[model samples]
Target: MAHLEPLDPKVDSIRILTLLPRVDNPNSKELFCKLENRTLASKPKYEALSHAWGPGQATDTIFINGQKVVIRPRLHDALRSLQTGKGRSLWIDALCINMEDTKERNDHVNMMSYIYSRATKVLAYLGPSHSAFNKADMKEMGESYHYFSERNCQLISKSIYWTRRWTIQELIQAKEIRFHLGKGYFTLDNRFNSLSNASNGSWLDDHLERIENHRNNMHSHLQQLEVLLEMFKDLECEDTRDKIFSLLGVADDTAQELIEADYDVDYYQLYASLIDYHQSASPLQCRSDLFRSSTYDPEPWRENWQGFDVSIERSVRVIAFSNLVQKTLNSAVNQTPIPESLSLGDPIIARGVIIGSVMSIGETYDDYVSSWESNKKWKALLESTYKKDKDLAKWRENDAAFYQEMLKWDHSEVAAIQSCDTTKSYGYRESQDDEHITREALDSVTEGAQPRRFLGTKGLMGFLPPGAKEGDQICSFWEACFGVVVRKLSEDRWMIVGRATVSKESLTPAVTESVYHDALNYGTENTSYSSLLSRTGDEFWAKQKDLAYEALIFFKLDIPTLQKLTA
Candidate 1:
């Protein structure tokens, strides 16, 4: 027999070894010894090897047997602790990749699977495994890993080289050994006691117990290896077609859905650009960093559009406010009470209810903004409407007790609005009368108040008292309605009349011209504004406006007005 030293000399604590069969061929044995004694005489030129290789080359790293080595980072730490100041040999896959050694790298890639299989105590240093492994940690988790990556997974090829794929079959076979199959084994601590208990003449128990424990540990290690193998199988094969198909199929659907939604145009554009780049990618050529670009910022467009939206929304709020006010005025105008009909205070109650409803639109919007973290424009719209309603609540005639009672009804309406999940009855109830009233208010306030172009008006029936304070210049009765009539009614000339709610405010001469201008220039707002004027003989206006107003009484004003109007 030829005298030879073992490939590595770092072994002291480990007693176990894998037996390799001697081959008949002298060259095969030489190659096997070379593979086994993977340690270099000196540091090999890695840069030359890496430079010679083209893309898609097989690569691997070799570790010498009996070498005190760390497979991964924490294992390096653990192995260092085992060393006593002597240079402990460590075989790291990263250091051995030989990036510059193209021929060696290519040859090593094909042998990686075999090299890893023969390794003793392959340390899977997943994370800093010098400490206990917490599988849940995001940074350290090796729960699942991509096998053949070209970009971020630069070290993946080396990792596969160190795994013992062939030994997994042996480990699976080891699971059925007597010690594991039966309860014939003791734990590591109990081995000594078990051996002492068994007589020297009957050493079967001690041997069987030790074998069982080894089998159990081997079984556990085998399971982990099987999972790791699954990551590497077919990774470097030509049949990468299936993987491409699987990934690309779902990606196409998601891209199509995003495009169809048309919600974020810039995001979709960026996604499409990335998809186009990926479809024509070469092996390992797809760089993850290239796709990490942000979509074009829509901040400028958002800012500009927000201004228009806010102006429109403000117009809507003003319309709603004017509507509430007009309803109060109309209610005060038609204060004729009926017996067995609901009290004047009942219509007084409805005015508050509708006011609460409109305010609740503001409240619902506020809640939406808060819940969705919507932008400031939406928040401002809700907040402004809320503030205006609060201001309106301060004014009153001589109905202090009635106003207090109305507050309860208003609260109930608000509660109902809050409970409503849909837009239909969030603030305004879904009644034919309420719908007509809202539409009429939107039309009328937008129309008749052009010079000081009010958004809209609300109507009620009772007449206002003549000695009304400016604050009490709001109608508060069964027949009363309210609206955000334009501020064009000059402070000096606008006079409060009966019940202190009616106001005779003169319009500027530009009222008709402004209404026409707005209608012609601004489509919806201006057209609706012009329609509010009551032409002396325009029977269509008279009928349509009156019919709409009368219908609103059924839902919002007092039960008497509803009964009379419907009657």
Candidate 2:
């Protein structure tokens, strides 16, 4: 290791290994590589070897430039298999980059995309020996076997090399890639030419398929780095810092600008900075995570995180109705240097208008789905859904349109929905075929099924987050939507439960201002959604307006205070 030489960074030069011809004892598992610098301008004719180090074990000795070097046995086997009698030149990250030099590691790791893309060819080593996983094993079942055996599927899924984070960008940016799966190999040109068909990306690992598809469809709203971050957050990596570091090479140019690669920062700051970026630049929508993903992840890190189920997409989105967080989150971009003292577990403080307290929550998700899925007709489903609820459902049939449109509780205006009298607005929507409900309207009702129905104080009826409770405050947080469920943990301390949707609202413009006072209680201590809406008069408004003004002064001009968002 002491014989390692540094490359001149002026021309972006890097080291490549030339595998020496086998010795007289060809059967020996010996490897000797000539490591030397190759500049990009000189057009080095060498293939880059991409492989996982695999838990950093299995000691194997190899000679480099007449000096002995230790590497993983898999890598040693790759050199032996890939080498020829003449010689084979390749750029292997483990040997080429001087790990002893921190600055050199930073420089090379930062531009991994360029290194892999510029290579003559990229050889991805998945196994160590000639008996390593190969598609040729499938030939015994049949050349045209449609379904892959459970063993082959298990082998592919369980392969550490396939799931490693670095492997993603290496395969993506490569100009050409050849597989080194022991005796079996395949490329885009050929899926070992043994399978029936491998035209689409199905031939690759599931992780690669998911990421590559997202990359292809990235021109749409899914272009943000958050998508990739959320998608591959759980991938395997030796170093925790690599969770974020590994994605930078393949992220969009604009997304890449949000954060810089600095090996000095701990994983906490790195993850916190990603949180800062996701809050500010991500698409306008509200996310409710299955776990506390917005706050922490289950990755086995230095920090003992409560891990996830590792199977589900924790972050789910629904249409947003307010612009509460826009101006407040903009300041996130200006603060580039994430403070080292930033605590990941610290709860962020947010100031907003307390709209209402949740009064009641409907049946559990499983029950509701069981009932709704079985009932085909829209009218029958609505009738059966509210049979137990005495409040909204009692008068719902009399004014079905008002109930369905959620305009019944909007005491401010009954004319909010133009067609209140049209029967089409009830169980059915207006369309060319008025006899049957539009499929979109029927499906949209439970598409992002919050499952539990809830009525808020002040007669606001809507769905609550999965984690939300009956008494949690549904706040209209500045730069956020209407149904953000927050609970008071202590005086002036609140934790976000999740985002909910307005009863029947869609993606409308977020209101710039609200008359909702911070301290006003819309519902009383024991009574639910009733009694609160009845107390009405100009005198009440007159008093409430004075209180609203007082609340504004208390909150300091309604400009939201930003805090670390924790669940």
Candidate 3:
């Protein structure tokens, strides 16, 4: 064993751990290691090792610079597998970086993108071969296999190594990638040949194809950021900040200056800065396709768009707002009604169904800004006034009764009342006969009151209901647009928390049925709301009769406007 020294940060160089060939004794406790120093400026040739660090408690002793050092058991296995007769020089992050030194770790991480890109080759250690693999069976099968079984493919695809956040950048930046599965080693270019005699060839091939697809998609720097965010959303890191910092170097050139690796800054602050940077740098293109549906017309705002200026403190608010607006517009334009067969329930009256056309589309930043400001002011007033005056609640209850009375009158009578210009106060008018009051007259008498936007429904702006998510669909009827219900919310109620986007392209009956069934399956198996519904007992079921029947009603309702839009 050789004694290793601290890496010099001043020099743009890295230390590589060279694992010597195994000795004669198979059960030998001792292992040899030699430290090789290389600098990027000199363009040194080395292979980088990428592997997942398993449980910290399961450690193995390895010789580094003539000193015994503890490393993860998996790393030890990787080193043993890579060792050759002539020995091998490898840059493994765990061994190469001084884990005890925070500054050194940061410096080394900063150069990781460059280090991997410049490496002669990258060896991905996927630990032992899966037990399902048999070497001889694959040799006979040859290239005749059309597809690998999904279960077999998942063995490699779902491995912990692939789940790591850091390995993504490492694997992507490498000049060349080779996989080490147990004692077997193979490059992607010749992976088929290496797998010719293995039973798990198809599985390995599928995994390789996925990796190749990821690599190809990451060719664009901006696209890489998008991929990174999606691919690593569930991936874990000890320091949450590293979640963003680790990908900075591999991200677009624009991102380099936008965010800097700082241990002092909180992860949320880093995330906010990243969102702000992305919004400013790529305003029109959102990172997730969930927010960028085909029906959204960015072209209308393209010329006058001033771009989103998301603040670090308000990043979540901005993102939520943007998502809501974009999703509503998308769902409204691409409405899809349920099939007729799904509807078996009797028609039930739906109150407050506002119906209207989109009178004019706002196509500028100023339009959005003005609308947002006005809404904020109105919200503030409502909150402040309601908090101060308890009488407002009583007034609203009385107004609701008056509105119900107006609803009972004939259309001509209602029209006459709507056209009236009476200025009598609501309180004063309420003192008189109920038949004498008009809707317009009631409106004029109320202090600080404005006519409801949906009162007549001549010009209405569609919006998502509270708690709507990406996959929820919106259905348009002759009179109004409605959210489709996947499951029953109550015995007499169904949930349509948000509008779902329907694809414009037409599907075959079978495919359409399959999609609908899948949605139902998801609702039943995955949703928390579905779980609550299940526990509602016999009373809930008796009232609902068949909840699915009610769900079908919402899905099957005919919407001419939506049909034409899809058509």
* lDDT of the candidates, in the order given: 0.25, 0.50, 0.46
Best model number under lDDT: 2
Q: Please, what are the lDDT tens digits per residue for candidate 3 over residues 1-567?
A: 125476556788888778888767865646688886777777777889988887666468888767787777888878877776677878888877776677777777777888888888898888876788644433222312222334534455666776566776787788788767666655565554544434554644654565576577564433445445544555655555566666766666444466676665543344334444544444323332323245444454343233322121121122232222223223221222434333222211111111222222121212223476654553353344345455556534443444344345342221111111221211110012222223221212344221121110111222222233223223322112122212222343323322322111111132223222322232232333345446545443454442332222222111221122122
Counting clashing residue pairs in each candidate, in order, gives 80, 10, 9
Between candidates 1 and 3, the one scoring higher on lDDT is 3
Give the Cα-based TM-score of candidate 3 against the true structure.
0.50
Steric clash pairs (candidate 3) = 1-66, 2-65, 2-66, 3-65, 338-555, 472-499, 472-500, 473-500, 474-500
lDDT of 2: 0.50
Ranking by lDDT: 2, 3, 1
What candidate 2 gets wrong by more than 4 Å, as runs, is: 56-58, 129-154, 192-205, 211-223, 279-564
Model 3: ten consecutive residues of lowest lDDT: 422-431
Clashes, model 3: 9
Candidate 3 overall lDDT versus native = 0.46
Q: List model 1 lDDT by residue over 483-542, tens digit each.
A: 211111232111111111111121122222232222222323232322434343554434
